[model samples]
Target: MGLMALVTLGEWAAKVGRAETAVRNHLAAAPGFPAPKGTRPRTGKGTPYEEYDEAELDEFLKAWEAAHAPARYQVPGDPDEMRTLGAIAKLLGVDGKSVTQYRAAIDEHAAHEDRGARRYYRTGDVVEVLNSRKGFGVALDPTRDRRRTATASEPGS
Candidate 1:
């Protein structure tokens, strides 16, 4: 019979007032049996509890802020520019691989530009690349006066 069957039989025998030695012997002989001593049974410490003192709490907060603080390369006006690969993946409804591909496309484009001019991608380039069709899109290079005019214009309907 199976180990389960043996266990069941052993349980039944114990219930019916069978000798303790006999039930134990039957259980011990069951297939795939391990000695009772082998199991490292879990002790109930329950969930781990953490206590933070004022100094420790302050240090932890500082460390967390430093780790999560926005990098200098991020766009000045766009909060989305602060996103990491995982955050970008979540926002764009895609995985890390897609983000990698987008980065590769940007690198390739930059390489292509380097062949003709000493051009590096700005934040706008990255934005365009992310929203581009097949890694290509119309990029407008605003003149200095045009930028000033655009900035001066008030928001309206």
Candidate 2:
């Protein structure tokens, strides 16, 4: 069989003949959007991605992308620097909890470290998640110079 009707963000963009950024922003702004499954208790932290049922992810994506609306302006890439979950979430057009799920799924491929009470992620890792999940073609070089290499693969670069 061919790819599923609702696959990547790019697929949704293609179906609606609009940019992926637009589709995401619209979903983010839509009323009554489903929040990410699983929550961290105030006393405890770290919700492993495995806590979510696979079907939940499918349902969310299907509903979110079904509209296929175009974006008003281009969504920019994450800055080539360390980013908090909120920053990454804004870039991905999802809530911060959803980003935690994505981070859990691809934790091995990207590097992250906890500083004090908050966990900080490399922008390269966030871009990798966007590229792999959204098919947005964001790139990050496997180099020591994180800042320089990360931006080297952004849209305009």
Candidate 3:
């Protein structure tokens, strides 16, 4: 596989073009289906949030299809597609306003214009903000050069 993915039930269902219940209630109980590797507390109610390795799941599904169904799986690379700020926010589970502000403040990354000149960004850049912890509590001061050395007064200095 070209990417690392620990997918949830919804994602799994989407990958295999099956209903969530079909995957949960039927296929998951099948002998050849892959078992969930981990689980977290559900956000609302119902069953705990179970996660599966997308690569492994795809491999199993591919074989199953060859033996039983009419399809094959194509494991994708890390999601780097360009998307609007709103789309990025939706995908990354962040507030749309926060993404907009962060994007504007960064003043980098030339956006691709599509859908009558709407702006879009690479998914990796947006994901990097979340993973690198550079998007939160960022101070943008016009008076101070961002490259300046941190003073003793700054936090963690």
Candidate 4:
């Protein structure tokens, strides 16, 4: 009679492994059936399913990690030091133009601070840009530098 009723039928068909085309046809033919709220039925543009095995998924994850491993170097402590597009470009081993594009991607609220002077990027943010990944990476805090340096300098002192 309504969208919820249609969605319930779709969910049941999905659980029973019915062909997506059949489910769509059924939904389309039903009178008073509203479109599902959050999901859109596939429009037959691309492959519907890849059907990867568990080992394939695991291998995909491993390849992703290997491709995104961070360079073995500590980032500079000052956020401002790393703020400039040129500086970020050098740090990430990319062109200045790429850095300019990255500046565009920065969250707008974070971008507008100190009259646009204090541009700070967490370590994780740099990693995300460099890795071209969706998630943030670990950020370097200036306050912790002293403790890090101290531990490095003392050979069991």
The top-ranked prediction according to TM-score is 3
Better of 2 and 4 by lDDT: 2
Point to the candidate with the largest lDDT. 3
Candidate 1 whole-model C-alpha lDDT, 0 to 1 = 0.37
Clash pairs, candidate 2, are: 22-71
Alpha-carbon TM-score of each model against the true structure: 0.23, 0.34, 0.38, 0.32
- lDDT at 156, model 2: 21
Instruction: Give the whole-model CA lDDT for all candidates, comma-separated.
Output: 0.37, 0.48, 0.57, 0.41
Compared with the true structure, what per-residue lDDT tens digits does model 2 show for residues 1-157?
Answer: 4432223433333443444454457553566544444422322354322122334435654665555422322234644567687877787676677657556544666667888987777776666565555322211231332322222211222
Ranking by lDDT: 3, 2, 4, 1
Model 3 agreement with the true structure over 25-75: per-residue lDDT tens digits: 655776878878887565466577778888878887666555553122121
lDDT of 4 by residue, 1-157 (tens): 3323223333343343333344346433544333333433344564332222323333443454455454443454554343655566677676777556546555432333333755555544554554552321212332432322222211111
Alpha-carbon error at 15 in model 2, in Å? 24
Error of 4 at 9 (Å): 25
Error of 1 at 23 (Å): 75
For every model shown, the clashing-pair count is 0, 1, 0, 3
Global CA lDDT computed for model 4: 0.41
